[model samples]
Target chain A: MKLAIMGVGAVGRSVVDLAPDYGHVVTAVADSSSAAVDPSGIDVDAVFDRKERGGVVGSGDPEDALDAEYDVLVEATPTTLGDAEPGFSHVRAALERDRHAVLANKGPVAERYGDLMALERESEGTVQFEAAVGGAIPILSTIADFGPSQISAARGVLNGTANFVLSRMAAEGLGYEHVLAEAQDLGVAEADPAFDVDGTDAALKFVILSNVLSQGERVYSLEDATVEGIRDIPASALDLAAEDGRTVRLIGEATADGVRVGPRLVPQHDALAVSGTRNIVQFETVNAGQLHLSGRGAGGPETATAILSDVGRLE
Target chain B: MKLAIMGVGAVGRSVVDLAPDYGHVVTAVADSSSAAVDPSGIDVDAVFDRKERGGVVGSGDPEDALDAEYDVLVEATPTTLGDAEPGFSHVRAALERDRHAVLANKGPVAERYGDLMALERESEGTVQFEAAVGGAIPILSTIADFGPSQISAARGVLNGTANFVLSRMAAEGLGYEHVLAEAQDLGVAEADPAFDVDGTDAALKFVILSNVLSQGERVYSLEDATVEGIRDIPASALDLAAEDGRTVRLIGEATADGVRVGPRLVPQHDALAVSGTRNIVQFETVNAGQLHLSGRGAGGPETATAILSDVGRLE
Candidate 1:
């Protein structure tokens, strides 16, 4: 498939680097400021080299990539809150032209699913965003295969940054701030980690899950979520929970009722009590009982593989 | 799709009962000694009532259901080893007539995958056997979505009976015989649990996984697997593992190299250490890192849900 990628950050760059391995060609690549468009394929190494040296990806405007010849549009731009701008517009332009759009950006899906689906209904193109929720885990496709109604509820640790801090606090008796600082130093947490540490990141993933589970019956946004983070969890709390054979994890749940994210105590040896940055989601299936999926919740290459998987699923 | 179930066992009964909920009909159902065939949907309740009253399912021969009208043939018979008999022939009958085959029987898949695929290739129908592996966990479908070649390796606790024994031994500090007896009393383990406790059950599932992961590059069977069971695991070993923050599970692994099933020690808090009858499978992907899927590994309703999911995926 011919691809047009928007955003030259970690995920987009990784997608450009790996697309060829999946039998796809990048016809266009872009960042917020610039783009490189070709009818054939972009030179991946040269593009990254130029970006590393503090130059634009190419000479054309960023918008040019959206209009470039492509079979699928990979929306890898950073996630936004309300409007889901530029990313939403980019997806709209692709769908308006009847081209598939695979998303790494969570903004459009989590914030404006109704509008997005409305666009999809009017066009021949399809939209897939397996990368938006749990990176590298085939969560969405599994839900699709089972049919959303088959699932009763979904709950999980969807954020790596928050989990790392909580688990570190439990393992080393360290405070949240200490672990946050360590995570940032290790590049596991961003400079501005509010989205992750404050529960919005995990909540957004669950919100998207709720939308999928609801199957157009209702739409959920950040406002509909009851979110609580691990910012206030102290080392002593982990100690208390550990004494009872339990530990705290930032758990996000999505059901027919609503979406909620908070620090919940799970059994110490429970599948949900994964250590380090590993994430796990447990699904309550109607006839199948409970199902759990776990893996790296976030990473550039990991998220890219999800995006590529989404692209591969596009008809 | 119209489904003809070729067994009146637990899984087959559940499939018949739940077929209508999934918008499918059971046109035929058969047991070892009797069969019920109808051009229209079968009266499931009457069939069960007759079976419960010590009578045959209907007035037809068991072979008659094999030739019954249906869009998909559901092979839910007992799993046999050599030749994968009757079940293999049932699937062949379906595919030869250009009808899809959804299997709950592990025999045709684990013992004769190549033969099954060869039949599928020549016919216009497809074959799916999600229930033949990890019951309701969606393991096979997840592997299919990712493309088997994209996965590096797979390892997990594939048998619930063995898992029940091992986890009981670990939790209650009981010997293998005691736990096996308790499991049998509770109906968690079959009266004759040789296939499970001796590792043949898990080995067959892993062999099937190896076959799928190889993507026809190679075929694996029970003989190819190095098998070990939980009978040798004593309470003392569980105590030793617990001292080191680890636990023992009947772990089955499948990779390009080979298939292996044995009792292994894993971190107590690891995803693979799921308790009770819960089963978990971990996939090491080339780019996505480690991915784990866990759920009820075996049960009548659970396995039936997997069969239904496969039926839903049929073209």
Candidate 2:
């Protein structure tokens, strides 16, 4: 299929690199400053060269993507959701043109899932957001397509930042502030990890999941459905749990009764004990009961891999 | 859509029970011994029903299900392949009649996946096997329907019996024979647990996943493919890994070349450590790099939920 990338950040580079690997044609690359397309497939294959030298798609105009005949539009940006009207609008235009949008952009799906889903449905196209929630975890697809028949509950350590913080504290007996510093130093936590620590990231993911589980026009909660930040979790509590054969994880859980997005001190016997800096989500259904899923949640290449994995479906 | 069940065991009953939740009709039940089903809605929506009491239908003959005039058929019989005529023959007969077959049974797919897939192609009906490998995990659907975009690898711990045995032996310091005896006594392992203990079970599951991964005919061999059983691993090795802060898991991994279906020891920090008994068989794709799913592998209720999950999909 003719695949066009929305940006050339880490996630976008990952998708471009894997385009040929998955037997797809990377036809165009679009960014704030630059937009490039190669009918010869030369620039499409190697346009990531600029990104290799620590630069993004620097010269691409977003409007250029409209002119190119692309089948799939992969949206991967730095997640300027509030200020993401341009990229969101770009993907929306692609979807309106009957091209499916494979989103690594959390803004379009997280903030406006119902509207985007409605748009995709109306276009008879798809807006695949597997990477938007769980990185490369396939959490969204599991809850959406597989969900109509399978899922009963979708819950997990949705935010890698909080999970990284809690995992470090529990493993090394470090205080929250110390671990938070370490996580930031190691790139596990962002420099300003408020969205993650405040549970905004997990809440955003849950919003997407809720819509998939309910399979409706859209699921919106203006009343704020129980969003508990992981910042207040005491390091001492994690130390105590570790001493008593347990682990502390910032868990975002969803069930029939709305949703519960919080940090829980899960027992060591639970799979959460294996929690690391990665993201882990579990699927609970009548058949499978409680199933555990763990993997690297935050990494440039991994997130990019997620975008590529999704392009196969969306593109 | 109206659904009729063949083999009213645990999986069948679970589907029967959850049919109401999805707003579908369970028209008939066909079992070897006692045939029973009730069109009345399932009362509770739980993962597993410990109770064994339910409304039953028809005690006469298997042909009764064919006469029910159903839209879909749920085939949840014991594994019946690599022998004489398998029970999937019954499933094929239903397919020939133009009914979509939701198979929790892996026997036919493992041995004759190509033929059945061809038959489905001819019939333009589906033979979904959601419960065949990992009940309610939804691995096949992800790879088949949505994987065209970004799939790379099909890997996971496909066997729950093996996972449970390893978990028991490693966590509690039990021996193979003792755990084997206990698994049987507790009705965890099958009568001839070769499929689980050996890599045959995983090998069969790989056949199903391969179809979705490559969108080509599943070509494999239990002989040529690497098959390593879990029985050969010493408990002391598991203990040694624990000493080094790690865990031992029976990983059934399938990559591009062939498949590595066997037991392998991985790090405690790895995602494989989180998978427990009756749990996930995850798939790592190009788009969705690593999707870890967990659930009940085998049993009546989990199988029933899986079958019913497919019913929800067809609807």
Candidate 3:
């Protein structure tokens, strides 16, 4: 399959790295970073002729890559919201050009699931976002056909950066300052980790999942889900959760009509406690019952693996 | 799709009962029971020859049903080891005639995954048996394209009948016989109730999952997985689990070389403790970490729903 990645960020580079294994030909690559785009790339089928119109890499020169005839469009840029110039616009451009978008970007779908799905419906294609939510867990594919009408409630730890901080504070008896410093040192924390730490990242993901599982085009509000960041909880709360055989993690609970996202005191023996690194998302259904799904939840290779899994399906 | 369920037992009858909603043409129904082969005449698209030969009834003869033209065949009879007398032979006959199979019977796949897979591969078709193990849950399908490098250990409450009896004892503080009697009265525990109460049923299921996940021709042995029934632990053990905030439920664990099948004291907040009626299977993988998968594990309409879910590509 001929594929193009919108950026050379964490997830974007990971897809480029895994392209060879999955039989994907990276004919074109684009990123706002000047180093990411060069005349003579290290290894490339071809480089694009930058369209001299806008700042967004893919959004500006979507037509330059169109002539090359790529099959799958992978949008893995930074997640942002609103009508401003964001990765969402890049995704919209890709979808407009008859390319099926496999989104690792959250802003586009979370803010505009209706519009994106309408584009897919019109084009007779799919805008698969399994990588966007659960990393490589493949939760979306599982819910579509296998878990239809079976899922009752969806919940779990989504933000890895926050989860690590909480786990550290709980296990090592450290304060938020010490844990946050450690997270930043390890590159686990973003330069500005507000999206992940503030629970907005998790909330956006919850909204995407809710839109797919339930009907009605109305998007889910972060307020509907009782979302609480782990930043406020004291180290003592972690000890209490452990005393009750549970662990403190950023958990998101989505019901049919509403959702609740917050730092939870989940019991340890449950699958949520065992989830390490990024996150674990669980969906409990009436017919199929409870499912504890765990994975990397974030990272380059893991996210890359998630994107490529669907890249071959563009045909 | 024109589908035919060979066995008119619990699962088969459930499929037949749900035929109207799923758009199925029950061209034939057969079993060895008197009701299955009765002269009042079976109601369907067409009734084939009728003459009881064994303890179960089917198209007068299993051979005759295989010969009849059908889009798909759901082989949902009782499990028989070694001889491959009925279910195995029936599945083979269907394959020879190039009919797609949605297997609910474990006899053939558990014993002949390699041979049947070879046949299916040769014929360019698909064989789905999600119901053969975890009833309604799509654990098999999840593992089909699993992201985990390898499954480390999968352990959970795999039996509903046994769990119910165990849960009853825990809730009411009753003994085995008293709970067994109650279970029998509730119609979940069969009159004899040996296959379910003993570790054999769960053992068979573990073997099927082990073979399915691993890419080897090897089959699992009873010794590979330690099969201890609920009878092994006294009802008092439930107190220990409760004191520690846990629940005792029968578990089937899958490891690298073999599997471990036994009842476990899963925690209250754990997905396994929440696992009720029929069966629930959980997979612990290296890549995705711990995944708790729950479903009906057993039952008719639920199992039939599983077969119907795969009917889209039955042919």
lDDT values of the candidates? 0.91, 0.69, 0.68
Residue-level lDDT of model 2, residues A1-315, one tens digit each, is 888787777777777777786678877887776777765453753556775564555355667765677888888866655435766787788878988788777777666666777787879567777777777666665555445445677777778778778877777788888988988888777888897898877877776666677776347441345888877777788778878878877777666676668777788757655455667777676445665656667666667666666665554
Residue A152, candidate 1: Cα error in Å is: 1.2
DockQ of 2: 0.39
Interface RMSD of predicted model 1:
0.9
- Estimate, for each residue in B1-315, the C-alpha lDDT of model 3 and write its tens digit: 666677777798788777666566665565544223322324742332233234444435655566565677778878776654578777776777777788888767776777777887776446778778777766676665553244556666667788888888777778888989988998988898888888777877787777776666465544455677777677788877888988787777666767766777776655567533645556665444455555567788777767777774353
Best by TM-score: 1
Is candidate 1 or 3 superior in lDDT? 1
Better of 2 and 3 by lDDT: 2
**CA error at residue B52 for candidate 1, angstroms:** 0.9
Better of 1 and 3 by DockQ: 1
What is the RMSD, in Å, between candidate 1 and the native fold over all Cα? Answer: 1.3
Cα shift from native, residue B129, model 3 (Å)? 0.8
Predicted structure 2, TM vs. truth:
0.81
Instruction: Write the candidate numbers in order of decreasing lDDT.
Output: 1, 2, 3
Question: After best superposition, candidate 2 residue B262: deviation in angstroms?
Answer: 5.5
Model 2 agreement with the true structure over B61-168: per-residue lDDT tens digits? 567665666788887777764631445676777789888988887877766666677788878567878778776566666555444445566666778778888888
